[model samples]
Target: MTEQRLRALVYGDVDLNLIDGSAIWAQSMVRALRAAGCRVTLVLKAPVRTGRLVDPLTELDGVLVRHPHAEGLVDGDAPMTVPQAHAVLGRVDGDHPHDLVVVRGRAIAAALAGDGAFRNRLWPYLTDVPQNLAGFTPEIHGDLRRIARAARTLLCQTEELRCFLEQTVPEACGKSVLFPPTVVVPPELADPAPRTANTPLRLVYTGKFALRWNTFEMTGLPTRLTNAGVPAELDMVGDKIHDERDDPDFADRMRRALESAPGVHWHGGHPREKAMAIAAGADIGLSWRAPELDASLELSTKVLEFGALGLPVLLNRTPMHETLLGEDYPLFAASEDDAVDALRRAAQNPDLYALAAARCRAAADGFTLERAAERLRAALAEVYPQPSVAVAGPPLKVVVCGHDLKFFTRLLQHLAALPGLDVRVDPWRTLSEHDEERSRELAAWADVVICEWCGPNALWYARHKKARQRLIVRLHRFELESGWPQKLDIDRVDQVVCVSPHYAALTAEATGWPTEKITVVPNWVDVAQLDRPKLPGARFHLGFIGAAPSRKRLDLAVDVVEELRRRDPRFTLFVKSKLPWEYWWIWKRPEERAHYEALFRRIAASPSLAEGVVFDGYGGDVAAWLRRVGFVLSTSDDESFHLAPAEGMASGAVPVVRNWPGADTIYDRRWIHRDAGEMADAIEVIVKGGRWDEERRIGQGQVRDGYGLPRVRDAWEEIVRGR
Candidate 1:
């Protein structure tokens, strides 16, 4: 077989051999490349006297250089007074020529690429480096900006980094490729099975000795596993390097936590292979990271390595794994109880572990060295694919306006993602008492004015303009519900778009405008590629997928679930909404927050609703939960489109919507029924019938065809272009 030809140089300021996450990261990438038949070369400014090569011993396999005087330095920039560091890097660039030299540190990487010779070959790879006021020194900022502009390519590990880079250096970020964290699993290394029913299960955590790594989550989990007659031992490996270790005072709380925790061993630090071998022997590896860290949103190398070693991995519910991996995995827990349950389940079901191992291997292959190389080469080849001709005219400058800040912000993101289209969003979500001044200022600068629920402001802009460029006003549920017309000057406005025909009808009725003047552009939920996994025996589960108290009517949902439970003791209600756990102070009083907590507990405890009422927590994955239920219910008092039911219907759930005032008097009556009673009846009927799944499948097809993104995008384009 022919060898896959590619070269990678892993250079950074941190000691590559240090027993830490950074060293593990450097090792994984290098090992992955070597396994894929790539000509791998690594460069590090190691300590002058005892410069030892890091894990995988790739230094010996490839090329290793030692810097005599660069020891004990955190930075490699000579301009910053570290002369030996710069000398070492300069020497590496001259002697060992390669296809790509991957630099990790921001400043040093930028400084290296600043040289014309290195600029053509250097690829700056950002490993989720946090940018804060403390770290934002003038030199660091300058080098980052330089690297952002000069490097032939930039690689980011997470979406957060991509979002951050776009804000910092948007133009340079356009050339960047998001190469998410991955693992390389050799067949021999990954053959070990997780602890089975006959033997004690071994649980492991191979990460830095920090609370942020969520060592605390593992505290009580081991107890649950042990109580279930599954002997569970939790072993924690990989402590902070000597210099990198924080003060003992930093872990004061952890010390207290360990006092009460049992069957948990905190091994300070160990060699790379030792840690990996220990991990390979474990049943499951914990990779629960604090969500606050933007870098943690990507799958950690620890999680990947565990999978590479063929251990069933346990993770918290995070975007980190979801975006890269699938929904069905061995374990995903948020709290201690959930951790216990997941642990016990994994311990009992060896087959589940085998399934997870298979998926993990598949995931590992998806992010192999060969795949990473292909992604890099493909991105580089297309960096500047367009010809350098200057005959094209200036790009269109578009300005979108909306009353609700969040609504406008989401719209802005959507517009920004559209390439070759110059778009600027004037977000007036924070309209002060002096909004008139602000609106006028923005009005003058805008070419195309998109007025969305901007009531008086929209009217003001309409009265001021003669529709020279374009003036569009979008009517939402609030505009119709409040009995307020779109409030735009019809003579000056070029287009009027209602989120739904019902909203448009309400506006037309109030304004005495012709129906022809208003265009119906329904809101859409993008579920083209959502995972709609069917849960076994999920027939009696009722799902409500929204957070707002008014729109969702949680109290009404509770009543409905109580009514259902009275009829069928097996019925369960799954309320999928994110709790304000981080911002509990907003509840005003302990009693108020406690009341909600009790409500959640009640739902979780009921045999019908307890395990059934999974607080699926905030975000777009509601589709997954929706598929597990026989019926989808929404008791919204009012809405423009009521996306929850629409989304639920799209996920193969039988939608039961309440008949609101807007639904009765709005445009058409295709979906909404009378009330929650009617919704409940519809759900009961679906449960009684064995055709609920088939019905929902047909409905899903209907939603995809009618209210999909492309359909909505087309309507939006027509409205904006005055077609």
Candidate 2:
């Protein structure tokens, strides 16, 4: 095993047998946490019947699902209610408690947040949180404060909710992390491009068939739109119908309408994926909720699912929706009349569906399964911090040999501080050669030797290392193309680490090493140290960290800044990197010198870029420097794993990356741009609009989820310990 598997206990108060949103959320939460490398033990709040939803979760490795009734927590099929479940919390905790306890109910969270056993390992995510000043009573504030102060993180479903929590409960200021409405996107969309408007425009709604969901009004769409000369139909998929005392006939009216309506179809109920497929088959998605929910800050999961399937959604024109889909979104509806009118208008102009689809696609990209996994991964990192080692026996001697340890410095320090080992370094003079006497002395004394780079240092160790020693090699971007990996005797090395999967495969092909022998561990970013509050004037400031040797594309950044300033003169570009002259290898080439010189001339020649472009001196205090940056740019032609932008994101700056290969996999696709113009366009929308605060906060969580130091540090230590 690799050190120790991350242990997590997830308790969501919902019946997993149903297709409700809360039920689906529990299922998706389990999947996301498992994807983040957790060995989860999920406890159900209610008894299972068909166990349909639990099937998918059981298929996942390192996941254990526990039923409340089967465990005797409840008498029979009766639910283990909040208080009932709270009594058995210790039983679920076991002898050695799970590293993280995720409680989903507000009352249960308040009950367990300050418990001695849970300590700082409890992560509480409540949907019933008060949203405004009117809702935040003194008693409620006290309850929220107790939970926030004791819990590791207060998970929020929307930025608006997070802001409200911070304002209403002061203790939740730094503890809140956005866990936005998560959706499972189809691997390939049913339709990539929008189809021209046609007759029988199909609209689909999936979830509870409730009055507030406006499903009853949706049945009238076909009649109203057909009379308006645009034929339409409605597909309603769900089984749950609440019995309201105030509105006793709501369900009966819905059933009679479905049975008698000309074009409305009712699918009883289906699993999440099946329901989504049904929605994907339709022309438009119905998410037009009642006016009562408009003041709520939570984002709609159904809207995200519809968008994930590439369907245009009909939603209420609330502030939350406006910020997500933009104010110009064509399908904003407030009532049944507004919805019918919007559909009629869209049918007349097919281009509106195309625009709506684009907007929906953009907004949904940030709430995907991958993004959810990343967010969960980051949240878990806080609960399981890197531990300072305590020696149990004779220290195991370990040494790191490399010419450049700049990238390995943080990791090296982590190992050196561990109490179990006597750590040392054998710094090589160059890539291929080392001081033979010093290297030999270290090799004899070391039980584990780590080659920081796949250069001569690794090759030499591969040929001469003792049989009992465990030698590990780490390969980077340059080593793959430089032919150094092919020279190493890979059989001698215990493991070869690569920064990414793309490079890992390339290294395997180059070395003919066994596929199982290689692992992809991303470079670590110190998220805890880097994440800080943004400066006051940072809204207009753009930052680019390494613009050197022409490939980093200083010219392209200048072009983007020029376009941005033309639209808004408040935009500025701050370039933080060493000048080209500082690198002798780059300056020795005349083309490199000419490229940088020309870029400098262009920036000075342009009226907009003259004062707008600032070149700050390079320094190690990047976290401190990133305070004044609002946006971080990656305009390079290519990259293996760009830590600069991840570092920027860790420091609460939005990332604006060029669509390099696999760029979307590393970060959210919403941040990746096709060209300099698109990058500028995206940035302008944030600065000129009201989404900067929310956008940067999400970025901060995204980067930590991807490459935070603790997760990577754990992976590296396992390789070193040969576990």
Worst 10 contiguous positions by lDDT, candidate 1: 383-392
Off by over 4 Å in 2: 186-197, 387-723
Clashes of 2: 0
Q: Scored by Cα lDDT, where does model 2 land?
A: 0.82
lDDT of 2 by residue, 258-361 (tens): 77787889887787777887888888898998998898888889898888888889999987898789889999999889999998887778788789988998
Give the Cα lDDT of each candidate: 0.62, 0.82
After superposition, which runs of candidate 1 have C-alpha atoms over 4 Å from their true positions?
1-15, 19-181, 186-392, 417-438, 481-487, 512-516, 526-559, 570-632, 647-654, 659-678, 681-718, 721-723
Give the per-residue lDDT digits (tens) of candidate 1, residues 447-549: 6778767366576667766445677777665655454454445767777778676677777887877677788777765544232445555677778777454
Error of 2 at 199 (Å): 4.0
